[model samples]
Target: MGHGTNLLRRGPRTAVAAVAVGALATAGLTLGPATAARAAISCEVTYTGYQWGSGSGGFTASIAVKNTGDPVTGWTLTFTFPGSQRLTQGWSAQWTQTGARVTATSPAWGGPVGAGSSFFLGFNGTWTGSNPPPTDFAINGVPCTVNQVPNPSPSATPVTTPSATPSPPPLRIVISPKSIVVPEGGTAGVQVTLSQRPPGNVIVGTGRVAGDTDLTASAPVTFTPENWDVPQTITVTAAQDGDATDGSATFDSRSSQITGSSAVLWTAVERDDDIVP
Candidate 1:
């Protein structure tokens, strides 16, 4: 029967070129750019081309597929473009070439990538003449490390103990109530706790939370954590000072390198020496 219909159409076109790699994430941020530390699961690829004539042109390739090990579930990558790039179309997964060897797999929702996480596969190609870029890449078959964006190594024995970059996760500014009780001149407000939202202004440091004498704040405190999303108030006002015998004062909100937590405002002297006839 015509050789079994050409072996069932070449066995599903060689299993659709055979290539698959599901989503992977974890590896602690850092994906698609600026990366280092080899082994454990690595792969990188980036290609871009544009011509639009004579044989047509238009290319875009992005394959990261990293992991560092463990937590796979599904993945497969194989590359070979050297030149004549011709992928046609692609989205998140399912892609297959034939001549220049290209195959990516992962469909039906496509997902899975943890253990230092990494999973990126973009594609869009259609070339005819020249469209270099795609020297090497692999996932299921190993091989993949691309991502070298660091130059300055004359190598004359230069190693001045400077190769440790990974420190940015310690900024907590919490300043809520802590203690408040006002009813003399009346007025109490102290709130400051921004989780994440600050690319500019952050100057907080009021006064009066020191030696108890009835609150009185609103000093150089100007925290604009971009909008903080919510909870952003700092107002403490209480001053009666006739003394019927109820006294308490404290106002202290300090923040040097993103760390503010100190609030206390209590005052209840009542009437302020008066007789509301």
Candidate 2:
């Protein structure tokens, strides 16, 4: 699904360049009334903004269409999504998704998007949890007044009990300077490692530490997994001055062996799979 094509050909005005390429090659898809009197000459469409792709599991967006109305012959776009973010595969156009709605259409070589021109279409999804992305959206069916960019919150607060007593498995932690390229106020020294299996004291908590916007640390240090299975290391010393972006460091576990941190600031309520990554 790599359909990202952009073609804009404007050479009209020589007596309406052969009636605008024969009215954009039979522009008929049932818009009757002779395409509404040829769209009353003066089209307009715009929506420029969107492109995302990340993983802890799933996310993909890529929308961006423009026309500013007036030279169109075809086009239609729609958007929607809130909870179960669906919509999986899409490209140059022609797509549909029910539940958390989505729609796109623009083939026939993108009919006629003159008057300024711009195009893009993308889709791919899966996000059954952590909701936040619906400040109201729309396009083609109008609305999309702009808004959709918010995903960060999962520092710590995930551990619920149901009963049956069987919990202990989730500590993949890995830090070894994974990122601390200091300089904005310089000062770095991180070394956190822990796989799984061993238990009996392993606490390291501060919540968030991705770029250390002005780094500063003193939390994290308590290990003992050198025989109960193997995998352990602890070293902390962070200190940045401010602003540069890209910081991370979080840990919490003093027994019960269950840690977390891959890039989820805060938002978890139940998840205990036996740890092993």
Scored by lDDT, model 1 comes in at: 0.61
Candidate 1: residue 186 Cα off by (Å): 2.5
What's model 2's lDDT at 105?
Answer: 73
lDDT of each: 0.61, 0.50
**Residue 95, model 1: Cα distance from true site in angstroms:** 63
As a TM-score, model 2 comes out at 0.19
lDDT of 2 by residue, 1-277 (tens): 2332222223334547788767866565445555645543332233332323333235566666555555666766766676766667788888888777777777768767776576677766666544345444444565544533444323223446587977766665555544343333344455555656445655544344343333344455556666433433332334432333444444332333453443323211111122234
Which ten-residue region of model 2 has the weakest summed lDDT?
264-273
Best by lDDT: 1
The top-ranked prediction according to TM-score is 1
